[model samples]
Target: MPSEHESFNTRMAKAMNDRDFQAYEALLTDDYVGEYPQSGEVIHGPKNARAIIEYYPGTLPRDTLDLKSARVGATEARWVRTPTFTVVRAEGTGNVGFSAMQSRYPDGSTWWVINFYELRGGRLARSTTYFAPLFEAPEWRKPYVEQRGPTADR
Candidate 1:
């Protein structure tokens, strides 16, 4: 069973993955700011945040049925939607939190997103996020590292 208590990052991940703008907005402060350093873009407030989500391009045309291992209690279910994003890791202390996420694009490519969050008055005050596409490790480093776990195939 999932815990009754969830960290800020965990809730943020669920809100983002579900594309629940209302829940996302509730997590932020009135003066919330978000930055994307790669594009030198900055979002000043929740209104812009909603605009960004509404304007994001290339969403999946429709959700697919989950043909594998989706169950409710002991019964199989096929209507569940596959998650487009996964929170690989997240942690926080005091008023600071950070999360690493894996995002799957409509182009069939995967990217990593790292987010640094700051909280004030128990809500998000600022965020800095970075995005980078997945790449194969250079052959030169083959001897120095070991392939491990689920990510080994990537």
Candidate 2:
């Protein structure tokens, strides 16, 4: 059985992977805030956070379910989209949580994303996310380090 913290992380990961904005919003506190330091953007409130994803230019992947069908209450299980993000890992203790993810974009690029979260009353009160494109390790560093696979434990 998953611990309370693990369950919370699982719910968060599921909401993000499904892009269920309504569900995502429900996981956040009314005063929730998120920051993207790379872009110098700050999202205030759950509604605005949802808007950021909903209105992102060409970012939303096309769902397998037809738009008309979706509007008619088609099951989400029938929905499919490409370039979805995968939660590499998530863990939490007390009021602090952390998640690492790998995102593949439609442009054939992959990026690593990390989010540090602060929870209040079991809902996200603050988050800071950082995104970085995957890059090949420099040959010079090979001698000094051991390569770790995706599932390698910290």
Candidate 3:
């Protein structure tokens, strides 16, 4: 049998794939903090996170999220989950967004929103994105583009 943490991650991914915001909302804690890359804004609380998702562009079609790998620890664990988001516009233009979430399973199955989503367009418009990191620690979190560097100190 899979661990509860693994099960929770799977369920969360499924809910997202289904575009069932209500279900997604259920997974989140009351004080969820969602980090938006494009805006450099951190949305505090579950209510705010839901509002942000509501304005997300491109109607979500197929929401198949696969758990690639997971690194478990005593208190906290980081998992690499990839959710392939298929979006379709009114003009019939389809685009795919791959979101790589690094979730920290605190208190076993209870998950927190550490990082996610690089928004595009001006506030309310289409967003085309690729694999983005979801940092667990606030201090470790930086601009997604910054992570792609060939500098002296990587």
Candidate 4:
């Protein structure tokens, strides 16, 4: 059986995937703020609820359900709002975050993603993630950047 923390994370993910605002409301703190770092968008309260409803199922899933979420503000992992449950950072026990390029689906294309979540009182206090499809850098910018990490196989 999953621990309560583990189960909480699972429920929130399901709510987002299923676009169940009420379920999410049950899991997220009433303040519930989500940030889209790439676009500098901040969604809060009822609007955040709407994002889960109108945005996820209606818009985001059409492109990628695997995308990570929010920046979590005060919050800004300066280590951000003190995470409570994160699958990537603390393996869903506490504090979750990861930046990786990986296959989100079996035999599917890879994506670049970063995600972090914070938990408070068994409910999500705040969370954030960013996602981008993998692509090769053009020759034009190669000289301006230094190589880093093990290169991903083409």
Task: List RMSD in Å for every model shown.
Answer: 7.3, 6.6, 17.6, 12.3
The lDDT of each candidate is 0.68, 0.71, 0.39, 0.52
Local accuracy of candidate 1 as per-residue lDDT tens digits, 28-103: 8988999999999999998788657644553222233222322111125322232356678776777787778887
**TM-score of predicted model 4?**
0.49
- In model 2, the worst 10-residue window by lDDT is 65-74
> Clash totals for all models, in order?
0, 0, 1, 10
Worst 10 residues of 4 by lDDT: 80-89
Error of 2 at 68 (Å): 18
Tell me the tens digit of each residue's lDDT in model 4 across 26-144: 77678877777999977686456655454421233323332344312232333221111223322354544322223232223445545566777876667676766657777798899
Between prediction 2 and prediction 3, the one with superior lDDT is: 2
Q: Which stretches of candidate 3 lie over 4 Å from their true place?
A: 36-39, 60-154
Model 3, 1-154: lDDT tens per residue? 7433334445555565555667766666665555556557766765666655543443232333222333222224443322333221111112212333332232223222332222222111222222333333344466443454432212
Show model 2 residue runs off by greater than 4 Å.
59-83, 149-154
Candidate 1 pairs with clashing backbones: none
lDDT of 2 at 9: 69
State the TM-score for model 2: 0.75
Best candidate according to lDDT: 2
Candidate 4 off by > 4 Å: 1-5, 55-113, 135-154
